[model samples]
Target: MGTMAELFAGLLEGVSEAVAESTSLQGNHLLELAVPDDAWRQVLCVTYRLERRADVPANSFRLSAQASTPLPFLVQVMTEDQQLINQVDFNGGPPAAAISGSLTSYNGQILHIRMSLDGNPLVFHLDLGQPASAALSGRLLAFTLASRPLPATPENEQWPRSVTRQAFVLGYEDPVTGQITPPCRTMPPALSSSRVRQAFLDLTNLGIRSPKVFPLLSVPTDGAAAQAFRDALGNVDTDAVVAEMHQGRQLTATRTGSGAYTFRFVPDARYTGPRLLLVETYQLTSVPLSYGPGRVIKTFTLLPGERTTMRVSSYRRSSQSIQSTSSVLDSTSDESEREFEQAVTAEQGNSAESSKSFEYNAQASASAKGSWGWGSASASVSGGISGSNSSARQEFAKNLTSAVGKNAARASARREVTVDTSMDMKLEEGEESAVERTIENINTSRTLNFLFRQMNQEYAAVLHLVDVRVAFFSGHSESREEVPLAELDSLLDRVLNVPRTAEVRRQILDLVGATRDLTGNTHPGFVRTQAPDGTELAPAVDPTYTSDYTTPDGRTITLPGIVTAAERHVMRTDGVTVDAFLGEGQGLDAYSTGLQEQALRAQAADNLLKEREADRLQIALEIARDGDQKRAEAFRTLFMPTQIVNQIDHAAVNTAPVNGKPSS
Candidate 1:
């Protein structure tokens, strides 16, 4: 199932479109509030898709929203009075003009929205057809290592003097690669329930390993064009691929059996050559039909073994559904749906996780880097945050920006053009002017902030960095050592994260081209910590605690096995929005940093309180060690608990070698 965030995005967009078509509001208003820049706990938005057959001059579209109930968050479309008015007054001069609008709420009601866009902003024409609603569906299979047959115990033993504890390690294996993936284990729900145990049994019995439930597609290695895509598949810009795939009204994912999916609606077939994008979605809202308030996409990787592992379960229970919406089962009436749900308690404790999705759907949502355990980094950063040291972050941002700007400008100022010397100098100067104009469009701050946030999470983009360590002025001491990242300490982690795991593994084995050499040496690129030119950074750091996932039999496993994929829909809800990237989220980054600063301040305050406590205890100990004879004698004059307790034989608190009694 999609993390709660994707669910809300897809559902809200669907609802908004349905409402737009259903609403009485008019005009060519094709405004969709699906922009990632705008967000909410649970919100609905109206969007527009324009279509005009011929060139025209001046066209308009307006869409309005009205709801009977008070909507919590209505982006773009509403005013102070909750009055929504989205209007396209007129596109002037040019035959066609661009349009942008905000959003309002939506509901079950579906509408027929008429859209028109004058290719030249001249004459407007309407396009018809119901925009399809996109949904996410998938199956969740949770598993654990099969228990080694317990050392045989006496068959008749009933005393239970020796109890064999079952060590519960939570995660699943990949269907295609047999690699085990461990899910993030933070605030897990109650586990003592029969249902969860049932799930465990169901998954354990499946016997298949590896979550690459989707069957592998063969990439054409013969054709020149095909070969190029195949070669680049090992390392490509995640955002570019996602952008290309989502460049339409919808992207469809069909289950091709064995819990695998094949995607459609890709603008370029070459992109689908070696890499596969998969997303898993589940409902977040309890409301029977509402998509949800938000979704959660903790981590995803171009490589499958990044954040989540997949296991194929051919054991589809006749009517059984376990925390998923992607199962093939007939839906019973609302009264009968309850039959599938029941609470599971740990064998001992009452604490447990809620059984949410028994079925789910997954598709591609590219994550820049595979999961690089950031808990230690977050902790270490807390130290750097002390004393309001914002200068470091600011300096880094400035330096990075300066470097990028210089490079862009330098590339643009290539005076050595292979030009006909006879050609006018105006042509070259005009090109320079265009380059200058392009600079105005680049929002460095927006791009920088996004990069900073991504850097804070994982640094796999520059996979050459086998070690990540950096020195910071921590309050504890200058140059104090810190353990930050331990799991992502090798190339194995990077290789697994690359798409087309099976093919990549085969290539590495054969040592073909850039693959591992006959000596089993990894790709040449695998032997570096810093980029050749040193633009990329791979900090050398360690983990806070010992992180070992080796099996009992000495089989070592690599990290980031678990990945979070989301359904790539008509509208994106699970990514950094266009508006945000274009400077809208500029100050938001600073705000986030401020929040981090505040958190550090809290930590500092906590440290201060602890120091005071220690000092206070030390002073008390010194006073006692010296002499309080006079004070003790005076206190004894009063009827104290020590004296009173002695008389009643219920004494307490007088055992500290006082009053000449043998210290009891």
Candidate 2:
């Protein structure tokens, strides 16, 4: 039983060897004949002239084989543990074959091959760059191997197992040297065309296209060179349009230094028409730098249906340093004079710093103002002391004060004045020239000088009074003290009242007369007095009445009517002063009696009106019935009897007291 088991095992091994050799013959094989110790896994294909053998079908042969199904020719190299290292494939057709054209060997060694058609095994040997006596021999054994049948025993009732092939090494070299590198004994694993197609699909989904998916190289940040490179990107037609089957379209591109940028394209269904995407790039420079006078650098990218962000930055340089240098030199002396020079230099340095700071602020302010259509102007003056011991504060104050004064004076002197001149001329000839008339008209209308003269006089008076008041008040001393109310009132009264202001009083009276004149008959009773200025003066009276009193009989009386005529007469004259006096005459008495009679009549009428209307009605009826006769009778009854009696008594007294002439 032991020999039988051994014989079976040997038979199976022989079949496996034959199967392996047959598969190698059908596939394109890679042979690792030799390798240096330090060599990495680098493979190369070398072509050489193959020497033809006389009896081997001209060193090339074609064989035709048939299988139940179309079969692929696969070749692989692996270890005994089934870890595959290399693989290759050949077209499974009798005519599609790889011809061996080279007799390449491992290192400087040669290989020997023998072939037989009688089903006998072929043998090969490798020299390994060593002596021929020390060469290794490999047998190409052959036997038909069939799939093992299932065992009937329950313990062995399993499916057939796949056999794992092992890789054979022709020779090896020292690990320390790279010389004598050899071809791989087994083919590398075949790359799937399906896998390559799937990789390409993934890239397409990522919006990668030809020319758009190129690798980006890193660059430097030197300003000009970087700008040049960016400009060049605009001229490059490296962008490609990619359409996705599922997702929307997109554009992918890479810059030299920066990373990749992807732009989404509008979907085909939604796209109305063709569209292009434009991209631009710019470099933002440091604050100290500026773009040239009128030139700016920009980069642009144009693509179809894509969105991209362009970095744009402008550059500018500060003018502070140059401006400061020029300003400092122009404003100062060149010669050094003792410590003063040092102090001046230090001051100039500080000024320069301050100016630079101010310039920045001014620029900002100016920019804002410019946008708003407004502008601003500013000037500053700084002064420094010659001695180090002097305080800067004191010098600054002095300078500020002087500057203010100078500016104020300049403004005052620069006052805008409009002047007019006029000339008056008699006609020197028969007819006046138009030019002469115009000149005359201009001269006649020249009133500015007069107005200015008047204004100057008034201004001088005001200033003189102000000065006097200021002096009297003792330089604002009075401002610190609070005056008593009574004292203030007295001062106001003194300022307001003046006894010698008779002329002013006369003028005021004249104004009152004129106002009364304008009021017409409403002021008919106003009497005008003649003043020394030949002006007629009238007593001031308020034309507007506050209240009116009515009698019981409905007779209205105003306050002005309340004053007696005697009182008005007293007011009109100055205590009966003599003017071209003749004597104290009866004329005044007659006038007085006449005035009194008129007053009596008016009073009587007013009294009668105050009585009951019934009484007035009865009297009026009686008078109307008897006509003038009844009125005469009533008057006689009330006055004639008394007067008649007085006259009779006077006659009797005259008759009794007088002699014979008295009776006459």
Candidate 3:
């Protein structure tokens, strides 16, 4: 205190000592805030308004504070729309957003939060750092952290900072293509044990055991859920059942709606680091149990995510299995009966005897004729009688006397009687012959029967699918301003949604084209055709609504050519026409063979033409040589007349004047 500097220093030391004592006392007082049945509790709420820091994705924000000591705490984040986004680190530890439990800090640490942001204000609630009485110690204990907000123009604006947003995408990166494949927007309906049990029960009750689920795998997997199927199905091969599900089976599934997305990069002052993209991939398998097979989705978690393009793997879209049966029965029967009978008898004999004979003869004759005409008439009459007598004299005389008396009183008895007797006679003959056939009760019976039975069964199945494809083909999108963490879920939903608009549009166009074709309104003027020489054919004639619709091979022939060919075929008269009947199966094969044979015949005909031309050429060459030789001989004979005269004279001299006189 001897000088002014000493005096000022001494005063400052005293003041500093007093101030330190007061701060200690205040801290002790705060620690004593806990009272029995009335512990101290406090809630802190803060609102933050995020502003665009640059022209980039600025949807991320950070909340940070310093904890004086470890404590039990709860923190909540919300958006302007009051949408709750749960975020927790358990007092500055690892995040535990998926866990639903109270959070406790282990030791004093720095409290921090990082999350997505949006255009709206963010509200944060901190419920921590309050002193309460210890049950055993009967004394107050405190764990506290203090934070204060900075003022801004807006009521919700605070000093919390925001930066470029970071997003994570899950997909598969193709090893071969060096591209990323996004997850499928739609997944098959989950098959659970309960559902399987229900389905099995239904099948059993309905007696429709042929029904099957498709694309089902047959494998074992970890977890009690996999074992649940066994309890439902008894005495059946679980693995076999699951494996058979996808064999020759069909299913119908619809894809949910989604949009196409792409990603591009542009330099942004606000973007500090690249966003995260996880390329995850998985395979679907089946696990067999008692009741039925179940689906198991296996995923690989350690795959790297450094690709730019991705593809999606998917199951088949549709499948089918067809089964059919046919049967036939035919039967016939017949019965019949008949009967007949016959008989015949004959006799022959010869005998000889002697006897006296008497004979009386008488004869009479009469004739009369008359003719009349207009101018002439003629008549004539004649009569005569004749008689024979027996050998007995009395009988002969009686007959003769009666005859004479009747014939005429002037008959003068012109009767003649004679008797004759034979003493010996010879005869040769058989005794008797008889034949009897008692077929009078003839009877015959017949029976016939025929039966035919047949049965046919058929089964067929087919399944096909294309890999998962993008329904939308647009580019990726990003907001320039911050997007709230609460709204991030919606964005992801949008990305996963797949729409049927593109497919529907294609189907509509196809249907329209088909309709036009059916109506014969396919714009005939626009239908172009080409000739064999590759020149464009003339435009189609006026639309003639003839019954002559186009056949499958109609396009193969020109209109005029086909017409002429048909006409020629119709006009043919010399060719043999054969009508054949063909049944199914082998008959069809034989028919096809016949058609091939016909084509071969046509080819042979063409070859025959070439052969004929060759033969004609050979014949023509020979004829030309002969004609050339003959022409040369004729020219020699005509040009050399002296040779002809000399030849004639020599011939005459050698011939001895042809009958001793060389005349003329």
Candidate 4:
């Protein structure tokens, strides 16, 4: 298979042939399933009848099979084959329980999946041009691969260990240096357009337009440092949208009596992968002075083998401010319009990451002046709700920087990244702008916009992948055992049907290798991403949200999106920040030249209208004096042009002076 899409298609064929036996492609709903836990057969079979959701066309995009019930949520697979089979003892003594596998390639490679562990199968990849930081193998243990074979005991005495040893390391542990290196977990494998569409529906709790389904690319933003913004500045047209979806119940308290209620979350049909469910409830017992609306927050991860999570939340807030007289209380008031938001956020295996918030305002003030004393105290609180550093290769950034000749004025880059970067977190710490108001909660697209300046730092990015075939009997190992074709067929089918992140790491690294530069603002830049024909990419379109929640609040309480309210906020663009920064028909068009043109056109029309009004008044005066239309018309023509000979530019006709002065 030349591409990831082709690779998955080839795998789906194998799975279809093995499961259905006959390669009849009619009414196929092809899919590579990561088998759910507690499956009966390492090799099992069942007969399934087919049904069509829609009438087929002459040519249609179809899957290999469609089950009556949707795929269930996947739990960790438990089997007896996960143990270490062979040994590679680095010290020539005992095989370390965990080994640090290296690529033996050059240092600072892009997307280096440096190490892996047995339990956490996801490969942890390092960013390009990262520092030469190695892990230390501190301690040694009798690893299953390196240690001598254990003597066979009675079945009841000890359980059998799994035997699947893949040479990989999360990182090297340096005991002497006392350094504990860490790596990012492998990303999810490539997904199909259909799969992504289905996942989008499940994650955002929204539907898509018909006949406009584009292939949704599975992008990785892990370890990428991005300052979250909610404004339209960075909104990409025809781009993927990442939103964190919440599924739970809403409960409220009564005026009195027991005020408690609970809601259970249901798994979505489209998202059959791992899931995380967070349950929460906000409580506000009364208004201020007697305000019982309280707030609480907690985070939760999905537990293995668990389908549901249960949580209980209870809160109350009461406060009062009063102006006091010498012996009695006076001028007391209650706080009004108090609101609280209780959010339950669960990011499922990176399906999506999103946030939601509520506007909360609490204010209290009291003042008193008497012979006893004068005192004043007031408090006001406004509730704002919210919401990877992908690094550049050291070599790429340093080398490209020097390429800009000394004659060229070097521009400083604040932060530069590809628009396709799906989701990211900021790696730097700072206040974005001292003059501009900082957003507190940035969940909306409007509020998430980052103010940035174009810099001279330029970069080029590319994505590429390569695959090589190896003979299993000889290449996989030195011939520990031989297998039958039937078993071999099943294994091949299983590999294709499952999502393996190792493959993803390889592809991402390949992309990094192909790219000359990805992100940075060190050197001066005038580069723009272009097509093969050298046409610059089109301007980004306005982004759409999963849903607009601020409409209900209206102008009285302006509630902005929370996606941008990220603690770390700001934008660093590849262009300048001035009015003339962008060229014709580019960004800032609506607010810049667009506004100037309208104002100028209006002024020119107003001047013409005044001239026309003067001509009409002059014609009326001439007609009234001469008592003839033709006479009035001739008088008007005398002032046809500005340079007329003997021109006396009089606005209206007049009679001879009655005494000393002429009168109209």
Pick the TM-score winner.
3
Whole-structure CA lDDT of model 3 = 0.22
Better model by lDDT: candidate 2 vs candidate 3:
2
Per-residue lDDT, model 4, residue 116, is: 19
- For each candidate, what is the lDDT? 0.23, 0.23, 0.22, 0.21
**Collision count for each candidate, in order:** 93, 24, 54, 59
State residue 427's C-alpha deviation in candidate 2, in Å.
Answer: 23
Kindly list the per-residue Cα lDDT of model 4 for residues 1-664, writing each as its tens digit. 1243344346545554232111100000001112222211121111111112243221221112111222211111111232221122122232222222332222332332211122423222232222111111121211111111111111111112222322222122233432212112111111223333454453223222211112111111222211111111133221243221122111111110111111112221121111111111111111101101111122222222222222221111111111110001011111111100011111111111211110000000011110110011111111111101012223212222222111011111212222111122222354131122212322211222222223221111111111111111100011112222113333333222234323322332232222221222211111123445978652111122111111111211111111111011111222222111111222234566667678789999999999998987887786897799677557556545343243476444444344556664
From the highest TM-score down, the ranking of the candidates is 3, 4, 1, 2
lDDT of 2 by residue, 1-664 (tens): 2343345346655554232110000000000111111111111111111112333333221211111222333333222334332233433443222222222222233344222212222222322233211221121111111111111111111111112111111112222231211222100111123322343344434323222111112222456644554454334332322224123222222221122222222221110111100000101000111111111122122222323322211111112222222111111111111112223223334442222222222212212111001011111112111221112222322332232233223322222222122222233354323221111112111121111110000000000000000000100111111122113322222222233223323322222222111112123233224444988553323333222333222333333211111100000000111011112223336676788679889999988777865685677677777778758567445543232235645643223223325445
State the weakest 10-residue window (summed lDDT) of model 2.
457-466
Quote the lDDT for 197 in model 3: 47
Q: What is the Cα root-mean-square deviation between model 1 and the actual structure?
A: 38.2
lDDT order, best first, reads: 1, 2, 3, 4
Per-model TM-score on C-alpha atoms = 0.14, 0.12, 0.15, 0.14
- What shift in Å separates residue 537 of candidate 4 from its native position after superposition? 32
